[model samples]
Target: MPPGSPSHPALTPRRSPLLTLVAALVIVEALILVGAAVYLLHGLLVEDAAAPIAAIAMVVMALIFAVGVGFCGWGLLHRATWARSPVVVWQLLELAAGIPAFSGGSPWVGVVLVVPAVVVLVGLFVPSVSAQVSR
Candidate 1:
């Protein structure tokens, strides 16, 4: 703890199961992004493979999801108290998206994602986890 070295208090790390749950969710989101990227890349390169506009849209969506996961991951890692609410919102959106994705032989994808979503939602509601995140 050398104060003259200019350590940042804002960079302090907090450990919590909730953060782990959030990290899991981020990982699941990255998997989904990879899946979409693979499909989109194939579509773009193949001759008359599929609807070009639709393929492009999927790639864009994947990029957006990746960016979002990064933002949420940062907040969770930093243990920002206010980040919980937005993260919860992201989980709900993921839940909605998982419905269709899981139905088409994507069960594992949904399972990986939904587990963390549940954890995050529960943590946000419970007093103990909330207090830890607040710290």
Candidate 2:
């Protein structure tokens, strides 16, 4: 088939394994955020949150970030170069949040939050992944 043909494998650049890993991690993070948003919404609707307004605000924020991060993951799958920066920013924020979890006596929570952020950050910077996204 010609290079431009729909069936041609070369029509889309191949995603490197590291790139795929980063994308998958980002998607997982987005899904988790969505879950968090739902939990916050539940609190606002059913439970007696001390600060209902604050809970509502948090739910909105989580939903927005979840959508943004989800799109970033989709962009990565499609090789959109613009997706990389937001993912990097998200990982940084995750690290910041994760580090505090350790000090709060929830070391397991810290590990859960920190590990994937670190992995995605490292994967994004790998030579192969860098090259892949640049195209």
What's model 1's lDDT at 102? Answer: 82
Task: Compute the lDDT for candidate 1.
Answer: 0.70
- Please give, for residues 30-60, the per-residue lDDT of candidate 1 as tens digits: 6767777777777798857558888788888
Clashing pairs in 1: none
Prediction 2 global C-alpha lDDT: 0.91
| lDDT of candidate 2 at residue 45, scale 0 to 100 | 84
Global lDDT of each model?
A: 0.70, 0.91
Each prediction's TM-score against the native? 0.68, 0.90
Candidate 2 stretches with Cα past 4 Å from truth are 1-8
List the lowest-lDDT window of 10 residues for candidate 2.
6-15
Question: Model 2 clash pairs?
Answer: none
